[model samples]
Every structure is written in structure tokens, then in C-alpha cells.
Target: MPLRGILDRWNNQSLARQFLIAGGLVSLAAMMLVGAYVTTLIEAAVTRNSAASTALYVDSIIAPLLPDMKTSQRLDDVTTRALDETFGQGALGGKVVSFRLWRKDGTVLYATPDKSMVGKRLDPGEDLLTAFSGQMVAQFGSAEPRDASERSRDDPLLEIYNPILQPWSGEVVAVSEFYEVADEFQQSLHQAQLRSWLAVFGVTLAFFLLLSAIVFRGSRIIDHQQQALTQRVTELSELLSQNKALHARAQRASLRATALNESYLRRLGADLHDGPAQLVAYAALRVDSQLLTDPRTPHQAREKEVSTIKARLDEAMDEIRSICSGLVLPQIETAELPDVLKRAVDAHRQRTGLKVALSMTNGSKSLPPSAKICIYRFVQEALNNGFRHGGGVDQSVRQTFDNGNVVIEVADRGPGFDPASVGPDGLGLAGLRERIESLGGTFNIFTSKSGTTVRMSLNVQEMEQA
Candidate 1:
């Protein structure tokens, strides 16, 4: 459970905190390895120096008493007294605690205060062998091998083994083993270890702090960029929402414009049929009644008068019919786009006797009724303009599909008028633009000195149904 808690805390930590923790752990491991190695080296050096100094002190006290510090020769009464005086109290001002001498064969030659072990043989271990090889060995503990003397002495001691040399030959012959009271030495070694550990900890902490600072700065930068990105996303969402609303409003306005244009066309058609047609019918009746009058004048004079009046009335009626034809449209509500366009061109050729080249491809049966009517009327008007303003020759109407939109183009080889010189009151082009635009379509006119072309494109899928 404790392990789980630690893992959970680590998981929930911020990136900078996690980074610092990981780096700190790695740094701690590195510091521990270096500190342990250095401490081991320091321990070895202190032990070597202490052993050498202890060996020197022991040798100085024992060298004069024994003529052969190496051999297993029995000690005399004078030498025995010297050994007791040196080690029973302490050697070198009470620094030494106990002492022993060994033969090369592992036999105990002498030990102060333990005279019973004088001739007992024991195994010479690795430390004893090292001393016999002319090296000193020391440790801060009781001596080993579980001997009776070691069992009786339990106090912490500096156990040292010093090699005794043959003075004349300079050869190691025996080893001297002894112990020293180590209360002060143990305390001093512990103090050194503590100082070394403190130094290592301080350095590790300083390095960890420096690394944490760098990680903290990077984390803050990441957080700031993330916040800015979030804000940008929010603003983009708002803009998209607003764009959708404006598009809806534009669709509503276009639908309103289309309805108004249709209303105007209906009103114009009604006015021509009701007002001008009635006036022409009444005038024709009056002229016929006058011709039927009896004996008003001589026959030829009356006939010429009636003929002149009849010709003028017929001319007026023809002009009114032409105006009415332009205002009213055929029943093209159920016709397809291609059929509607063909009907308009066919009617123009019948009325004006002008041949129009036609290029058409079949499709767009899905086009709405209003779109079909608009196409028909636009084509009819364009053909009329070609016959009146243009030469009425070499005209063409092309209908095709481009990118899901139906395109109709009418062209004429006529003297073209400048668009800039045309006034806003040019109802033909202006009404065409508004009609196409309302149905989510576009109208464009391209004119050169040689010819004039008007093109209309409509997307029936986007148009409002009527």
C-alpha cells in the first residue's frame, strides 16, 4: 500500500517535478557510489598509518628485551619480567592493552597475563601470514580465532600484527601480535566518516537544485504555449459559428430578392394585358363602327379614309402585342433545364427569323422549377437584345454543366456597348444579375468590339424552392 501511494504521487506530479525527481535520484545514486569509494579509500589509508605506527611502538619496547625477536627460544627470568612490566600495565604510556609473540610454526611463545598459552600451537591465519611476510596488519576489533584469551577480552581493541626481523640478515623470522585500547581512535574514525558523508550530501543537493531550475523554466514555457493554443482554438470556433450565421442571413435575403422579382414580372404582364390590350380593342371597334356608317361620303373617298384608319389601328395593335410578348412567359414550370432553353431559342427564331446556333448537353433534371423559368426568360431576353442592338446574326446559345452548377451562355456577333457607359437603370442586365444571384447563381457579361456574351450559372442544389 505504501508503494502504491508513492507510485500514485509520482504519476500525478507535473513534468518539471517528475524530471527533477528522476534526475535527483540518478544524481543521488552517483554521489553515493563516489562517497562510498572515497570513504573506503580513507578507511584503508587510516588503517595503514595506524598499523605502521602501532608496529613501530611495539617493536621499540620488545626489541631490547629479546635478543632473538623471531626464534622460539624460551624466555629467561629477566625477559619475562620485562614482558610483564611492559604489557601488564600498558606499553608506551598505557596505550597498549595486551601482547603476544608467535613462532613461525604457529606456536605461542609468550603472551602477557596469559602464561598458560606459552607453548600452545594455533593456526596462523591470513593476517598472521601477511605479518610474517614483513607487513603490518591492524583492525579495530577483538582478535579472532575464538581462542580462550580473545573470549575473555571483549573490549574494542586495535589488533596489530608486526613482523620481527633478523637484524643481521634483514629477514622476517617471527610475528608479534598485540592489541591497543581504541576508545579514542574509534570516535575519531567515526567523526571523519561523518564529515565525508556531509560533504557528499551538500554537493549532491547543490547539483539537484541547479538542474531543477532549468527544468522549471522549460515546463513554464510549455504551459504558456499550451494556454495560447487553447485560446486560439476557442477564437477559431467562435469565428466559424459567426460565419455560419451570416451565410444563413444571406440566403434569406437572396430568397426575398427572387420573390420580389417574380412579383414585378407578374405585375408588368398584368398591366400590359389589362390596360394596353383593352385600349387597342376599343380603338379597333371604334374604327370598324365608323367604316360601317351609311352614306356619310362618296364610296372611294370613304374607302380610302377607312383603309388609312385601319392601317394605323393594325400598327398600334402589333406594337402592343410585341410589348406583351416580352412581358409574359410560356408555361415552363415542369420543363427540364435543357428543354426550357430549347423552347426559348425556338420561339425567338420563329418570331424574328434569326438562326441561332445551339450547343447543349443533357442533365440537370433535378433543377428546381424557378431555376428553369429564370433560364428561359434570360435566354428569351438575350436573344431579343441580339436581334435589336446586335446584327441578329451568328448568334449562339450554349448550355452545359461545370462543377455541379448549370451554365448557360448566349453570344452574338454584334457591336458591343461599354459596360461602364451603361447606367444602373439598364433593367435587362440588372434584373438578370439579381435573379441569378438570388438563386445562388452568378451572371457575367463579356463584351469586345467584335461580339457580346452573357453567361449565367446556377446551382440548383442551393436554390430555394418556390
Candidate 2:
């Protein structure tokens, strides 16, 4: 298949499976490249540094021996002693040296690994006789010997050959040799490669783990959203079914109920304005007249009566207002849901002297009166629940709007109750849920150790019909 087709197929798979495959491939490739690069660079640097350091060490050893060799007439003993001292058993403990001293006649005077090689004609290939003509030669490779059996079993070697120059004329006198075991340098390079692999392995493991976690979390969120959408669709289907059955009954009952509700609200409003308010005004006049005329009645008692009358009047006014608001509207109209929510929150805060925060986003637009009413009632019920159960008096309420949905969340630092433990008898939230779902919306109530949150989303199109 083409790469694009393969990717499309992979994309259709579960997020976790796709992530594991893609992450493993990418991580493995990157690790391999990094490992190769790091191992090569480190090995090269180590080889170069080791070679330079060894060369310097050899020069230091050979430099001091040059003067001693030029001054001595008895070259054999002087050369032997100098060789023994320079390549002392301890000095060549971790190194290999094959030194051969020669006279101007191209004959060997001393060769280490054996005293027998002395007095032998220098083999041009096996012995570096060209260095005797006042030249320094250094090569990193295996050594050759005249006797095959005397050759090194270890493969590669780093050898440095320097000529012994006469101080006066700078003429070549004798030669010095130094060779290093390559196994140590090779082992260092192998260790560097191992470290590179280990580092790459560690980073790859962490990368795969992080990728897996992201995939798992994203998959779970997708599943949750899908489930929520499915539930919402199911609810809407059921609501439509119920609406079909109730349409005839609603036509018969809704008009009468709405008329009666409006009439009751207007009567209640008039009763409050005409009854308790007027009664309170008359009682205040009585108290004022008593305070001015009656010296028999104590001032404190008169003042107590006046305060009691005022408290009763306030309670009566509140009762009347509550009764009137509980009545449903007679006619519906398109209203912006956020504006209704803001008014509800504002009214609650004003009555309780609590702080409220309202945030609206997107362009303010109109919604169906039913959705506005449902959302307004949801906020009202939530605030009531907060006051009754959440100890939300003098607390803060926050409402947020996004897209075409409004989220009214009232939180209090007061003692919270577990939503899971709420019984069937708790009709407040049940009724709120019914109202919200009646308009093809979703309702979610979340309560935790910190506080409680009630979230509901209304479909903008459906809400416009309401």
C-alpha cells in the first residue's frame, strides 16, 4: 500500500495502538542514529588523544637517553643499561617495546625480547634501519619479526621509532623503539559504544512511556465524550417520544394553567402592595404618634414594637414576591439565556449580599424562551440548593458562557455533600435535570471534597424554538 493509505488505516485504529507503533518506530530510528554518531565521535577522539599522549611519553623517555648514548665510548654496556632503564620491566608493564640499537655499519648491537638478535645484520623490513639515517617514524599496526614464532599473538600495535642524533653534527648514532598494546584502546572504544547504547535505551524508554500515557489519556477522553453524546441523543429521542404523546394533552391543559398562573401572580402582587405594606405604614404612624404623645409607655418598649412590625413587613414582602415568581409566564418570547442567567445571579447576590462573577463569550444572541426559562430555573434551583444544603449564604457564584451554551456554576467554601449519596426524595436536582433535558440539553452534577458543580448544556437551535 502507499504510505498515505497505510497512515490513513493506522489513524483509524485505536489511539493507544497507533501511538505504540509510531512511537516505537520513530524512537528506535532516532536512537540508532544517535548511538552510531556518539560512538563514532567518542571512539575517534579517544584514539587520537591516546596516540598523542603515548607519543609524548615516548619522546620524554628517548630525549634523556640521547646525551648519555653520545658521550659513552663503550656502546654495548651503555646501550644495554640505557635500554634496561628506559624499558624497565615495570615501565613496560602495560606496553610492549622492541628496541634495537645499531652501529654505522647497519649491524644490531642490542634487541630486546632476546639478547641473541645482537650482532645480526639489520633486516630492513623487520627493523626500522631507515630511522638510523636521522629520521623519526611512527606507525600504528602489527609488528614483523625475522622469526615467525617470535611475532606477537596480539593483532595491532602503536610503534614509535626515533633516531639517536649526535649533539655536535646531528649525525645518527643509534635508534629507539616504543610500541603500545592496542587492546586497551579498543576496549575503551567498546565501553564508549556500550554507554551510548544504554543512554539511547533510557531515553527511548521514557519517550515511549510518555507517548503511551498521552495515547491512553486521549483515548479515555474520546470515549467519555462519545458516551456523553450518545446519552444526550438517547435522551432527546425519549423526549421527542414523550412530546408526541403529550401534545394533545398540553394543548388542552397549558392554556388554562398559564392563564390561572398569571392571574394568581397579579393577585398576589396586588395583595402584598395593598395589605402588608399598608399595614406596616399604618403601624409606623402609630409608633411615631405613641413616641411623641405617650409618656406612660417606655421608649424602649415602643422601639421594640416598631422593630417587630418592620421585620414582619419585610418577611411578608419576601413571601409575596416568592409566590409571584413561582408563577409561570403566560406567553413565551425569544430571550438570550446568558442575560437571564446574569439577572438570576445578580438578584441572588443582591438579596444575600454575596459576590457573583459572570463571564459571557461569543456574540450575545437570542434563544428560545423555553431554553431561557429552563436555564434560568436551573440557576435558581442551583442557588437554592447552595443556600439550603451547601451553606452558600454570603458566598460566591460564578457563571460562564461558551459557544451557544451557558454554564452556571455556584461554588461555596461551605460544607459539601456527596451527590452520589443523594436519595430519590431529593427532587430539586431531579426536577432541574428534567427541565434541562426537556429542552434537549445535558445535565451534569459533580460534587467533591472541595465543593459542588452543576453543568448543563443547551442546544442553540432547539433553545431558539423555546
Candidate 3:
């Protein structure tokens, strides 16, 4: 299989199985190391203890019989005979497979059952050196040893190095090395090693089972939680689908209503311009014609009255035309967001004849036609309020896209009005807020003694979704 396929298969396995496989391999390696170390120590201890017992027995029998070598280098006939009697047919007969007594000068003083090998100048091995230094060394010649110096020999024997000290001065005068038939010792050593390995295996099994039980319990808990989380996620997905549908419906309704409201405003503006504004203009023209085209000479006070009436009619006509212009909006539905905002600022500048700072940065995102209309109306109302109340001082219009949301701000550095006094219904602010919120956007106004700011933030992503 490919590497990715293997990884996927491994990942698909249950958590418990994965841990069991991994932890079992680790445990097996640990058991092998611990068991080997512990059994090796057991075999060494048994070999030493058995060798010490045999060495102690041999030392007891022979050390008393041997002549003190502090005075004589060679053993006499009687002393040599006593040593022969002990190893040949006495207490150590069959158990002693081979025995040798060495002098400090490396000459064999005695050999078991055969005295011809006596007086042979054999060099001392490392074991003999240790015995000469007043220490006993022991080894099992048929078993694998933990240390190299305690290495096994060919025959099945327990090798012993017994140091013989002089009775009076406690000085080691001679060393005795013996090899005993180790059938019984080997049996005991093998039994001990087996028992030790069984104990290690038992401990390893108990530890592995205990850890596996704990992990299995934890894995079950995690699996249960995963199932519950999956179910909760499914429920949330359904609810989100329903919310999206409701939001789309609300967006459609808001669009339709806004279109109808704009249509009504346009008809109202056209009516005032054609009916009330035209009639007012005609009345002003008739009064001016009457004042100038009259044949009769008029009195001074009456002439002034006719001229004043015509001037008032002209003023009324101008005010009517202004109201009509305010009601009808420009054709901004097809324009982009930046162009729409520019048109609003330009119109405000021309009407008020005041400087309005307009700032645009990153207004390149595509917006819905309804959103563009909403933004235009928002800027229009906020600027008009700022001008009427703030004396049009230091007016600034800023537009930007902030984290996928379009933020437009209109602010003025003038004496601000108290928001609480205006309430929610005053200055058409309530209508503007309704209009913005209906399209899933936000409107906020901040007013203080230093200045006033009207900010509108719209989420372009949500608008696009709608």
C-alpha cells in the first residue's frame, strides 16, 4: 500500500487498539531487559553461595591438617599423608573431581589421588592470585557467567579457590583450588533462574493489564464524547440552514419595500413641481406683471404693497421647489459604492457651499444595488443633520472596507446636540436606523460637546449571501 493509505488505515483504528499495539511492544522490550538482568543476578548469587559452602567445608578439613608453610616451604611426609587421606577416601572423596594445593612460589604442593604432579612449578592464574590475597573465588564451570573473569570451563564443575591462613598469625600461607562435581548445584541454579524469570513475567503481565484497563476506560469516554459532539454539530447545521432561509426572505422583503418607498418619493416630488410649485410660480408672475404693466398711476404706499406681495410669492415658489428637490433622489442604483458616496458629498458641497472633506480607501468591493441605495440615503441624511445642527463646520465623510465590512462615517467638529433630547423618532434618524437594520446592517451615532459622528457599518459578505 502507499504511505498515505497506510497512514489512513492506522488512523482508522480504534484508540484502544492503537495504544494496545504500541504499549505491548514497549512492554515486551522492557520485560526482556529487566528479566535478563534479574536472572543474571540470581545465577551469580547462587553460584557464589554454593561455591562458598563447599569451599568452607574443604578449608575446614584441610587447613587444620596442613603444616604451617611460614616455617617450611615443603610439606613433610606426615602432613602430606594427612592431606591425601582427606581428598582420596575421606569426606571429600567423590565430590572432589580434581584438587591442587599451591605454594606462594607457584609450585604445586599437593595433587588429588596422584602425587606425581606434586612439585610441578605451575604459574598462578588470576583465580589463584585472588586466593593468595586472602579472598575466596568460586565459579560454575558449566554455566554461562555474567562476568568474563567468572567464565565457564568445559566440565560440569564448581571451581573453588580457598585461601589457607596460618592458625596463629592469621596470615595466608597457601592457596587451595578444587573443582567439585556441580550436578546438584547446577540443578539448584537452574531452578532459581526459572523461578526468577517466572516472577518477572508475572510482574510484567500484571503491569501491562493494569495499564491497558485504564487506557481502555479513557478511550471509551473519549469515543462517547466524540459521538455526542457529532450529533450536536448535525443539529447546529440544520438550524443554520433555517436561519439562512429566513435571512434571505427578510432581505427580499426589505428590497421590495425600499423600492416602493423611493417610487412614492419620486411621484411626490413630480407632483409638487408640476402642481403646487407651478401654481406658486404663476401667482408670482401675475403679481409682477400687474405691478409693472398697470396703466393707472398708483399711490406711494400702494405701490410698495404690490411690490412686497410679489416678492413674498417669489420666495414661496423658491421654497416649494427646494422641498421637491430634497424629496427626489438621484439615479444612484447603477453606480458603484465610491461613485455614489462622491455624488452625495458633491451635492452637499454645492447646496451648502461649504467645504466637506471626503476620504475613500479600499471601496472596491462589489455591493448589491439595494446596499448602494441604502448607503447613499445614509450619507445624505447624516450630512444634512451635521450641517443643520453643527453649522457645517469641519464636516468629514470617510469610507472604507474594514474586515469584509463596509464602514461609512459622517462627522462634524461643532457644538453637538444631546441625543436623549432628540429621542429615537426625531430628525428621521429612526427611519434611517430601520432602513439599515432591515438589510442586516448596523447604525450608530455618537454625539458630545466636541463633535458628533454618525457611523454605519454593513457586512458585505452577508449582503452578498442575501
Candidate 4:
């Protein structure tokens, strides 16, 4: 119906059908060409070899009758009788039906049973000219219509014109024309031509079959290899997609890590400026004023001023130590998960002097060192936030292991502020969220007028093994 439809149908065809159609068309075209060429060659070969044999037979029997015709330019009485005896009334083995002796100028010297044609000059055609040139020429055709007598005896004839050579000189003197019945010989030639054609066709068919078989096997192998290549390409595409997703995740983690480092630096700067830096600056100012106002006013007063300065210096040192303690963590490489959480809670209690109710459930005790640090920091920050912002009432910390996950919750029964109204730099919630997510954990908060609860869950086995 359409070009596209034809293509679709051909594509849907089976491989065997497609190959067979193509091979058949190719074989037919090749055989047709070969058959035509072979037939032409065989015909030429058969004609050349058959003509040579027939001409040789005619020469041996007929050449003796015309030996002296060069000088006579005509056949004698004896030669004329001999010709009649050879060809008349089914004579000479019934092969020779008729005969003529011609001079070189196409003058008929003798004609058997047709004496009226004798001594008549006619045009010597191409076949007679070839014979007079010392070669025998033969063909199958009717006699020429130029002569009335020849036209009267018309039949399908095997005509031969042979040169009658002089015995001593080996020169052509006269030409002998003969017409023979060739029914049996024609049948044999036909049979040979038929056999040659069949043989050529058989060879062509066999060669085509062999070539088609080779093509079919190779096509099957190519199809299999193509299928394998397609499957391999699909698998590679899937792997590439997975690799791109992993790369994107790594980039996001890198950005979050940078943000966490910046937040940490900002917090450290603020702690130093508010605590140790302010105290140290004030002590320096007071020392400068005393030196300028009363360098030697009273020894006892200067001693008292030295005591106050010493107390202020001692307070500044304590504040610096407190900030340092917050920054530096205890060595807990060899500690258990429960022991690590207990240290954070004990430190909070020592610093704030506020009691926190703590509960724990049996869970995976072993953890990677990074995971231990995350847990301790999370508990520490949540407890500190509760005392500072939640009035430290009904504070509780709970730890449980559920379905291969470590779950932790910190809650307080105090008035909670709205998370939506929180300032950008308050309470380090964003840093806490990033910290938990970086470890492939989750952080969440539930706050209301009753209180606030901070919850975190981590894949214990995965985080520890990683």
C-alpha cells in the first residue's frame, strides 16, 4: 500500500524467507547470463567440428573426379557419368541427394539428372568463393533462388562446397557442391546442445545453493552478536545513570560540609569575643588607669587594687578554660555507645547543675568513632538548648534500638517558641540537621505550647560499618 508498509512487512519477514528470496533472485539472474553465453559457445563448437568432418568425407570421394578440370575448364564425359553414378537414385549410401561440379567462374560443368543446368554461368556466391580459395565451407540451408532449377529442388539441405585441388600442384582448380540429408546428424547435435545446457544449469544451481548456505550461517552469527551488543549497551547505560546520581549526592554533601565548617568558625569567634576577650580587655584598661591616676598614692590601696585585678584575671582564665573544654572533646575511641551518651549527659549536668531524666534500651553497642561523636554532640546540644531556652523543667533523654535503627529523643516540658519565627543564627538547628544528614541519619523536631522534642534516627549497622 505504501513504501513504509512495504518496508515494515519485509522487516517482519523471517530470516529464512528473506534470504531465500534474495538468493533466488540472484541465482536466477546469474544463471540466465551464464546459460546464454554457454549456449552460444556450444553452438559454435558443434558447428565448426561437424563441418570439418563432413567436408573431409566429401573430399576423399569427390576430388578424384575433377583432377584435370583446370585445363578443360569443364568436366569430361567419364567425370559426368561418375557423378551421376554416385548421386543418382539414392546412391552413395543414400547420403548424397544431389551434386554439381562448377568451374571457378560459377559456370556449371555438370549437374546430375538436371542436364539443362549444364554449361550455364552464374554468380559464384560467398560459399563457392571460399571453397575456390582452397578451404571447404558447409552450412544448413535451402538452395539459392537465383537459379530456377535450384529453386525447384528446394529442401532443407546440408550444403558443402569443397575445393578440388590439382594432384601435383596442390592448387584449387574446381569446386564440388554437395547436398546431403542430415536427419540423424541433426538429431544428435540437438541432443548434445540439450545436454550441455542442462549441465551448465545444474552447476549454477549447485553453486548458488552453496553460497546461500554460507550467507545464512553468517547472518545468524551476526544476529546473535548484535543482540549481545545491544544488551551490553543497555547495562552500560544503567551504570552511567547510577554513577551520575552518586556524583550529584557527593556534590551536595561537599557543600553542606563547607557550610558546617563556616558555622563552627563563627561560633568559636563569638565565644572568644563574649567571654575571655572582653574580660582580658577590661583588665588591661584598669591597669592602665591605675598607672596614670596614682602610681604611688598608697601601698595598701595598691595592694587591694592588685587583689581585685587578680580576681578578674582569674575569672578570665576560668572563662577561657570553659570555652576550651567545650571545643575539645574527651578521648572516647575505646568507649561503648552507652558510655559515650552517659559522658555527654554527665557533662551537661556538671555544667548546668540541672538534673535530666535519661532512659536507654538494649541496642548495638559497637559503633564507628564518627558515629559515636555524632551521638554525643546531638545529646549534648539538645540538653544545653533545653536548659537555656526551655527553663530546664521535665527534661528527658531516651535512647532505643528498633528495626536495625538507633533512635534518640530529647524532650522538655517548657514553653516552646515557633520554629517558623526562629532567627537565622539562633540555636544551631541548621548545623545539627546537616550533621545528622551527612551521617545518613535524620533529624526532626516537634514543638508546641506544652514543650519541644528533638528526635534523631540512624542506621546503626550501616553507619558503624561505613
lDDT tens per residue, model 3, 133-197: 99888877543322233244444778788888888888888888777878888888889889888
Q: What TM-score does structure 1 among the candidates reach?
A: 0.53
- Among these predicted structures, which one has the highest TM-score? 4
What is the lDDT for 430 in model 4? 67
Q: How many clashing pairs in candidate 1?
A: 0
**Model 3 regions lying over 4 Å from their true place:** 1-14, 142-155, 250-466
Residue lDDT tens for model 1, 226-317: 88999999999999897787588577656756765776777677776676666667666756675557667678977786776666667667
- Global lDDT of model 1: 0.78
Go through the candidates in order and give each one's C-alpha lDDT: 0.78, 0.67, 0.82, 0.79
Better of 2 and 4 by lDDT: 4
lDDT tens digits by residue: candidate 4, 280-358: 8888887876643686758787777777777888998998899889888898777988888889989988998889888
lDDT digits (tens) for residues 178-292 of candidate 2: 5667777777767877988898889888988987898899989998999999999999999999888668555544554555456556766687777766767766676567664
* Candidate 3 lowest-lDDT run of ten: 142-151
Top lDDT prediction, candidate number: 3
Clashes of 3: 0
Ranking by TM-score: 4, 1, 3, 2
State candidate 4's TM-score: 0.54
